[model samples]
Target chain A: MSRTNPNAIRSNRTANFLIYALCGIIAFVTVYPFLYMLSMSISSPDEVVKKTIVLLPKGLSFLSYELIVQNTQMWRAFGNSVLYTAAGTLSNIVMSLLIAYPLAKPKLVARRFFTVFLIVPMYFTGGLIPSFILMHTLGLYNNIWAVIIPSMASIWNIIIARTFIKSLPYSLQESALVDGASEFRILFQIIVPLSKPVMAVIGLYTAVGIWNDWFTALLYLPNSNLHPLQMFIARLLVFNYSSIDPGSRLKLDSAVTQTGVITQMKYSVVMVTTLPILLLYPFLQKYFVKGVMIGSLKE
Target chain B: MEQVVVQTKPKAGRIRSFLRELKRDRQLLVLMLPAVLHVLIFCYIPIYGITIAFRNYRIGDPYFALGAAARWIGVQNFLDFFKSIYFSRLVTNTLLLNVLTLVFTFWVPIAFALLLNEIASKRYKRVVQSFSYLPYFVSAVIIVSITLNILSPDGVINNAIQALGGRSTYFIGKAVYFRPIYILLNVWKTFGWNAIIYLAAIAGVQQDLYSAARVDGANRWQQMSYITLPSIMPTIILLLILNVGTLFASNTELILLIANPNNMDVSDVIGTYVYRMGVVEGRFPYATAVGFFAAVANFILLWTVNYVVRKKTDEGLW
Candidate 1:
């Protein structure tokens, strides 16, 4: 309803202004870091060393990006991250769908028992040490399987997928059953095609999770060759930055010391590791949001 | 004889029905096989492996060879942890870090969602919400790196401080700034993502109620306080309970990345301690004991909070 009274309009205007101002400030705080990092990464080493660049680039340079491109180790880690994310997400989706489809069916015997069986791990675990020990015992240590297999299924995602499947017209499955379609056939041919939205939600979740994970690599993949892009970035940005003397590294050019290049590389590495997900985020934001919404509709 | 016949008949029928159900759902069971086997190997085995806390377990020892092969220590690890010099400090640090984070960061998303709901323009609201979620998608490594860069002695914050005629402070190097920096980072990363749920809850609020409130001459603040806030209270309480349940857990990864010798006293939490002890130092049994204690504490806190919430308001995670 429209209000014509001066006081009503004045108060509404005040409230609207306050809300926009607050939200704008919050949004700026959230986004300003990425902007700063981007600007810092591209800024000249001189400006970077002087700490002159804050919100915008000065004497913009592509030197760090150039160095990062030529860095074979970073590229290898990038390749590893891609492979792990693809394998992990595929496994996650397959296993989640497999378990969720059965759980979705009311006619499936002991569905409640199976659901509880899966969910109990969410509440309690053997903690990190035992899991580490178990990994070594299973001979997954220093192997890529260590990273991909353990996180293949998440009960939360399974529940979300199951909830989506349960909401579909049961008659579709019923007719397929009458047509003598096996449960596997119905899951693959009938349920999966209709369940693309939920699959997207879970797939994106798993992909992002695998993409961002470094602790798994740190714990299990002691082999530096198997490190993901995140672990590589972490090494450059967090672990070795302070301990190792940057000046000792081979210099790219005389314009900047190894120290300055290393600083710029730190920002560049973060962008490199982060850019893929951030680039895909807008296109996939809805599915991510849908995942959360579906999860909230708890079983 | 009649009673025996009655009992035996139902038992026999139940067994037959169970077997028939199993046969009919065999395909579904087959589908569930991979996940079931995965969990048994990865999850349940580790759970059984938790028994190492009670054994005199060492690195390279046979983990599963229990009884005579692995010496039984009978809660010695637990006793050692309790009696250690670091016990009180670790407990304090973990609780303080989490409780402080909970206090400072929990209300941010709720406030953000409420304010966004108040915005008249849907387009502006959408843009603001989208920007808010950017940091949440970024890896913790990146976030910590950014934090370090901004807080470094020669970084932006210190530069600003010097420009403003103040002495530059090594923020990360000091124990005092750890909590605020961590809490701020958590708020920045989570506020937008967490707001999605509250926004969803707010969306479910009946539009008719708002219209009615308007007709009754209720102001915006009054409507929010009287109608909107109460409508989303269940969601708010449910989330709060969940947050309380995780009070014993810290952002171990972030802590590990950020903590240094300078701030170790204040920054060392149970997760970091366990990581250092078990993984780094190879004190597997000791670290496992510490982790198990934390896990039990977390479980108890979650259940207690859930129980208390259900008692008071009939809202809980369960």
Candidate 2:
């Protein structure tokens, strides 16, 4: 690519090396925190507080993991998170498909009105206060349905689906209609089967979103039993510090010893909550990039 | 032209055409009904929910009866919010955070995209890109927890500071450190993911332009400045214009986690403020009023900035 500029090649080579070095350092900075957190979780509680552990654990211990296992709330929150992500993503894809199919059809009547109706929510909303009141009025507050229903349909997903479906040649659907297939049959058997790629991308994206959301649980569900995994992890890390027992307090008199058990416990919890999603990340990554590219293509 | 077309058509003929199209697409329209109803109840009803900002809303009042029993005091809620002592503080803090975010965080991704584009090895580039994109998927709770661990008095960051002969301080609790820490973490979290869009734009640039520049004896930096940067300017401007709308927006979780009572003066923005007022204190009307004003300002700024960008560069989000 650079053969035309022979005289400048040497200087460009040096610049390229610098760019590689800089990006390498940035990648290190990005991954170092999680590695350190993992190291802390596995290291002995004493070593974690004394700051002896950096990239590797000084002494292995499963005490934090044992504590997490003994806690029932942790398991309950995990179940809630799984339920929300699985059910929420299914609803989102179905709802998005229903809306996107009609909007994608050129022969559909009132297309302008329907498209604008869907697009308006992207710009403005009722604001937080009124949204809360509306939820409360609907009897959704403190119910599991609160987390599921409001987020059921995403307009951006609809747009992406519409674009993907519209990109297909019109004759594909026309032939299906010529075969005496009804619109419903064509949508389910033909358009949907052909939409697997977009559907998978949107599904993975929405699942990641629902899995990581803590604010909805914080606002709608005041009951501790109903809290999601994220909310539970947040409480342990931020709000529960004062609840350490007197026996632990005696050991915490030293500056290094003060944060021994709870700090390690928090690290372990972070690993537990994020490890599943991180494991699923590589599979979703290619589709994630494709989803963004599909979104950015001009209408 | 549309009006002229409509005027030329007979009324019965226009109705007949409409009925024909509707009958042809009835199944498709029927499939859209449930989604439309969902949006109507979930999204559109919330638009009418803003009326609670004007009324003295109570918990027991039925939603529809808000107009009748919940005494309408015509902007009194808004007046109280504007007259409150924290009004300017909230406004200033919100604007300061947004401008600081734009100045510090916006360009990092563009630069990252350009640097990545310059890398010679595709394998090495993929490794670094994947690592950088990892944090954007991490939850905010986990990110803040990591920050809390690393920035603690005896944590890695302060340990390094101590090695350099500086005393350790509680970083999260300090009002002065709030903005820098917030902006820095946000930059780290978003820069890689945001760069994907710019990378896409760069990929779309015509290869012939670069070839032409190379043939003209332009060096690498010169070619980048003249060819690549000019090509991606529209994408950059479009994103910038969109970002201008969120100048008043702040992430509530990030602020809520990092802020203590000690640092509230600097860390408290409109989102967190409304959350505390409405949920914790049950001041629904007042919170609604303050939030509505902020949202209206945001919407107006979105259109105004988009209009200005369109006028100057002939590119806007219509």
Candidate 3:
């Protein structure tokens, strides 16, 4: 295809330039806040107070980092987040696999029953109060199990995992069955090994979800010591300066050393909580796209 | 939708066949036991607990016994919610917030995808895509913190405005700005990740259509309008239907984190209301009633949206 008009070609080039520029600006807007946060976190407290540090750190200091590192409760929260994420993701994968595999088999008995049973709840929930009451009744309230047990199996993940398993060639499982392998062996030895990519996809989703979860801790873990990294960060943000009433927020700015330390501390916590996921994203980005496609695309 | 047809024999022999099948797939049954039990206890039991809405559920009520020792007062809690001072405000705020997001953000990803499709350089596209997708991985707490920091009286936005000879504004604390800021952040976090679906759909469009359009003297815009947009309409409609299913559901965590007492007038949604009333204030029965009403509305919305989409476009979540 050739453009006959030089004027039209020039106009098309302009349009292309505009599109690229818009995209670039949007990308910058998406990333600039984190960069600003990073710059503020590293800047000297005096510089932070006296000047508006936009793009770069002025009088860079590790003072905020030093303070964060010295806090044992912060470290404990980080450790708790790791513990929950690891255990929660493993449970999610296993439970999802257990349910998804059988459901993916067209020959399984009560498959339709199980499907409806699970899918209905995806659209309707017991609501927050009922779930809270249920947690209390089950002796999970204010306990770590409150975070882990209720989320052990996500129906959406199960559906995607089931779809992935269903798309795998039936012949693989059929041939294993013909060899007198038990159902468990077929799942472990055949399906599990073959479904590694989907497993990775769901695993990544579950890990990220668990890692990012603050609501669970906020609602369930009223005890401060049990708070995960996200909950701790949320607490710090809202209660950063004792009160966010306009008068106090203004006054708190002048009392920078006493209260404004929280502003820098907030940025440090944001980075610490977010950095691992951000750092891991590039490596897992391909799988993220794959997971979304697998979940959304119709068979 | 594809139906899984399980062949059956006579009705009288169904139980016998099921038993035989169960025995044959005992290992499968064993594997499903734990998950089934977990779902039953955690998911179904809480669903069963919804009955508390009709009863004055006390703290020490027997866990398994429905309304035991607590007098049943059907519809009183619901009536209380309907008559409460905050009722209309909560509903309005919840619906307005979600509808605003739906209206403003629903097509942004499609537009982003279309723009991304125009890029000639693959490497540049990938870099931009990665950077845009970065915010999706950041949690709600950090995103809200970032928002609050930016819109804080002395934050960057205010600082920039001051530089431009404007007065500083406390955007976050103001009720008027809550919905816009919330919608903006929602779109900012999601557009890139959501665009990937449309991007995948656009990639599937036949290359010959573009070539044919180009030969017909069509420009890039004409080619996109004629070919790419039409090809991705089904995916777009499907996603739209799914979004509408949650028309009453606001981003609970985001709202809860971003909203202060001052901004509560605009930011209080059904989700946050439930959290405040149920978890914070310990109004179990009343909160459960409100939540039940929300659940019913959400389910009806989901069903209606799915039905309409299926009828009109033959694209829907089944």
Which lDDT tens digits does candidate 1 get at residues A55-109? 9899877777877777778889999999999998999999989988998897788
Candidate 1 local accuracy as lDDT? Answer: 0.87
Q: What root-mean-square deviation over C-alphas does model 3 reach?
A: 3.9
Q: DockQ of every model listed?
A: 0.67, 0.64, 0.64
Best by DockQ: 1
Clashing pairs in 2: none
Misplaced by over 4 Å in model 3 are A241-263, B1-8, B66-70, B309-311
Per-candidate TM equals 0.95, 0.94, 0.93
Q: What is candidate 2's lDDT per residue for A191-274, written digit by digit as tens?
A: 898999999988988998899998999899989888889888778776553232223333525655446666776788899999
Ordered from best to worst lDDT, the candidate numbers read: 1, 2, 3
Q: Under CAPRI classification, how is model 1 graded?
A: medium
Better of 1 and 3 by TM-score: 1
lDDT of each: 0.87, 0.86, 0.84
Query: What C-alpha RMSD does candidate 2 show over the true interface residues after superposing them?
Result: 2.0
DockQ score, prediction 3: 0.64
CAPRI quality level assigned to candidate 3 from its DockQ score: medium
